[model samples]
Target: MSAGLLRNSFKGAASAAPFFPTLLDQIPNAIVIFEADSQQLVYVNPAAESALDLSRKSLEGHNFHDLFGDNLQLGEMIHEVKSGQAPAQRQELLLHSLPGSIHQETIPAHVVIALMDDSDLMLMEWFPIDQQLRTERDERVTQQVEANKELMRNLAHEIKNPLGGIRGAAQLLEFELPEKGLREYTQVIIKESDRLQTLVDRLLAPHRKAHVMEYFNVHEALERVRSLVLAEFPKGLKIVRNYDTSLPDILGDREQLIQAVLNIAHNAAQALSVEIEAGVAQIELRTRVARSVTIAKQRYKLALDLDVIDNGPGIPADIRERIFFPLVSGREGGSGLGLTLAQTFVQQHQGSIACDSKPGCTHFHIQIPYRRQEKSE
Candidate 1:
């Protein structure tokens, strides 16, 4: 909100007596008023304390410049407002709080500086931009997953019937062949048709599973995947587990969870084949719990956070966005249905999986909400 706009809102706030502070506390954006001569904060609302990671009492007598002087750009902006160089101005800044507060990291924010009319005091408002951008990106990815679901259903149906007919005809012709050489030709057609049939069945597999819900430990699923991966690549790859044992059991299908996690681990293993040969391949399975989280635009009080991190040559940029699609594969002989199936399973449990990759690191984050079965009173 503009300084003038907030000033106007506070015009009759005194009439409300005890509720005046409450009104200022409710504003989401941080608001701070500074004295021109002393260069110290004169009034700071509750929101300012939260956004700046400093309590109002702690900030009351501290010079604004002293607290934020390390940021040269922000200092210049403050000087501009103090000298009345402009009526009001806005700029994006990287802000870090003083050493006193719990938050010690820098945050990107859009800052607004405005002077209160006929007063030496100026109001500076801080608004963080990270969460806003993340929310928008999440919405877009979720919509894309929904659209993919519809396409998979229609595409699978279109291929299944013709695939079965071709396979049946090839089988009938093989039975009628009189000589071994002629039978070999029929065998080729039958074998190829059967292969295509198996591919079609995989495409239809997600919808075929029964979602048998039960309270199951997420670590159990992780362990099952780890054991399977080790069994496949014993000599080269090393699987590390970092699990939070205190996390609550998730309401989900146990076998499906295993398949979902295995696809990701399996993909990572394939990507690290070269590194595995060199004895440098490593994958980590990490689990944690996040509170008051939002997934696919839905809010949950508690959610399970699973990270499958790999030390491999990251996903190729060309097919990164298309990696979750049914037939898109990065590997030479890969069917490319692994990640698609993984996504389908997680989404069925009202969850989301996000992937971030670079040259040395590739991380897939799977977030599923914790929905516990209530105990009998």
Candidate 2:
């Protein structure tokens, strides 16, 4: 090779090397490059590592089919790229992986399989369905939270001012009444005032209380909530427990956990009331162990997975994303603080709560870290 040709060759490789990897890094989606012939991962970006809940060190040299199942559609997409069919557009794929146990995920990906310098490589880029939806969601949630605070403040002031006066008037009327029958009307007014006071109390609970953390068994917390829900909907609903006994104890407040779990289960039971009347309202309490979990941008070695699944009409699309904010309710008589408070409690424990809903199935998945290593006293 001449000196000029040698210089041109070095420039070409340098330009291409930076171009591909830099492009991979800049893209918002998780990108992974695999050697088509060897069926091994060639490169993975930080996003890919986070999406898969695995470190780049663990992902390198691993086959896609081995990490995911061999039968996954992503495997077939890889085959097509290697066979000289360049992917024309982005593809949506559902992936199943058994890291330790079965896990199912739906991923929206854009893939390109091509020959780079006489070597076949498959480039796959994916973003989680939930993460893509979260950008718009977070903005809306911020706005809603502010609006809710103002609304709560104004409503609390408006209601609290007259509540005492109403009770006082009711008491005066009770004393003035000559007969027991007339006193019943005053008693009803007093009861209504008390009910309104209770609602106000619930509305202000999230803002007024401080988070207190302690070590507690998650299963015990779940069972406590389950029994309460079953008792309330005893005639129609069947609450089933599916506990993963291997899950370690988590550090969280027992009362808060009880309230959080009960809120979710109570909402589920109420949603299933109609079905329960027909002898079909079924609520499942499932607990499992999640590994390499990420909650609030932090990773945990072990996490507890608690799922509350109900058989009812799923949440409406318009408000599905806003269900966690204060005063967003699905039911007519519901105050809507239940889910909001539940989410607040869970986040205080450095956990996350997510919901997946369709026509007949609604699942609220809660992920909280478990204490894998105990502190020495």
Candidate 3:
């Protein structure tokens, strides 16, 4: 994350250290402190500067409410906060004509007013609710994923030890059986043991590979998966590319990422058997740069946003939550390891994946943080 973003995120901690204006300049929210009587702006945070898309030099010493074009509700809230009639607390509403951002979309904010009683200054903080909710959601997701990994690691270890012995015993017994009927029984045992061995090996696959890191174009992996998918579903499956070609090359395991995307696309193709038959199946790979993202409680200024969207029947509602759990498959005869493996591979890159599904739509959103090439100021 940018230093400004970092400072703003920890404003409470920074407040005790000093009263430096630079501390708040890069926050992701619009904060303006003003005199109660004159309504003259005293300070504007960096987030407020960015939100309005104007410099503090241009906005300071101006009426804070005057910058808003026609947001009666927001203006009234500001007036009330300035009056100090009562503590306005937090109010949710829309703001219009934020100076330099007049042509941009309307800004929705959770506005809170605070009284700096000692200085007789009124502090108005306008936070975008979307960013607030997103940070909270990211925190929760991180916690849940950590919990899932711990449980799965323990279970995999437990299942790992027994399979080897079972397979070895079956092979030893098969060589001793001389009668054809008894040998047939031994053969069945050996085959089933081999199948279980393969299954157990897959359960441990995510941990087996050394994460080879190299700077690679993400589209290379996407295109490879696209070709592989097309080769299988040539008749009706359409793979659309919505890429941000301007994105810098990402550092990751190319093979693992290819497998991750392929598994997701393959799953979609399977679900769209009917659509593929009727020539209406469509799967999309979209990419964009995400801002102000929080992964594992760490803030990031830029992250890759890769979305795989399918217009199939969607994931079953009952199993949506467990879609990434090992052995949890919604499809008949499905091994259910694809998504789990994908999640593991992405996590290896210090990134993550999430899914949202409803009938006729399934979205797999993957986020991978860009490693900063230089130290952030």
Arranged by TM-score with the best first, the candidates are 1, 3, 2
Expressed as tens digits, the lDDT of each residue in 355-376 for candidate 3 is 9899888999999998855435
Please identify model 1 stretches exceeding 4 Å from their true place: 1-91, 95-107, 110-130, 373-377
Q: Which ten residues in a row have the lowest lDDT in candidate 3?
A: 1-10
Deviation from native of the Cα of residue 344 in model 2, angstroms: 2.8
Please give, for residues 1-377, the per-residue lDDT of candidate 2 as tens digits: 12222223223443535555655655555666656667666666655655675655666447766656765466666666666576432465665542743344645444443444434555666655665466566556645665776787679879987998999999998998889899888989999999888888877776677766667788888888988888888887888888878777788778988899899999988888789889988888898766555555566666778899999888888889778877789998888889988887887777778898988999999888875445679
lDDT values for all models? 0.79, 0.72, 0.77
Which residues of candidate 3, in runs, are more than 4 Å off?
1-25, 30-90, 94-145, 373-377
lDDT of 1 by residue, 1-377 (tens): 33333333344343333453456556657777766666556566655665564555566457776556578887777678777798777999888877765437688889888776636677788877786798898778767766876787788789889878987897888888777689888778778878877887898888887788899888988999999999999978999988889888889999988999999999999899899999999999998765546676676767888999999999999988778877889899899889989998998999889898989999999989998676679
| Candidate 3 residue 128 C-alpha distance from true site, Å | 5.0
Candidate scoring better on lDDT of 1 and 3: 1
As a TM-score, model 3 comes out at 0.70
CA RMSD for every model? 7.8, 8.9, 8.1
User: Model 3, residue 176: displacement in angstroms?
Assistant: 3.2
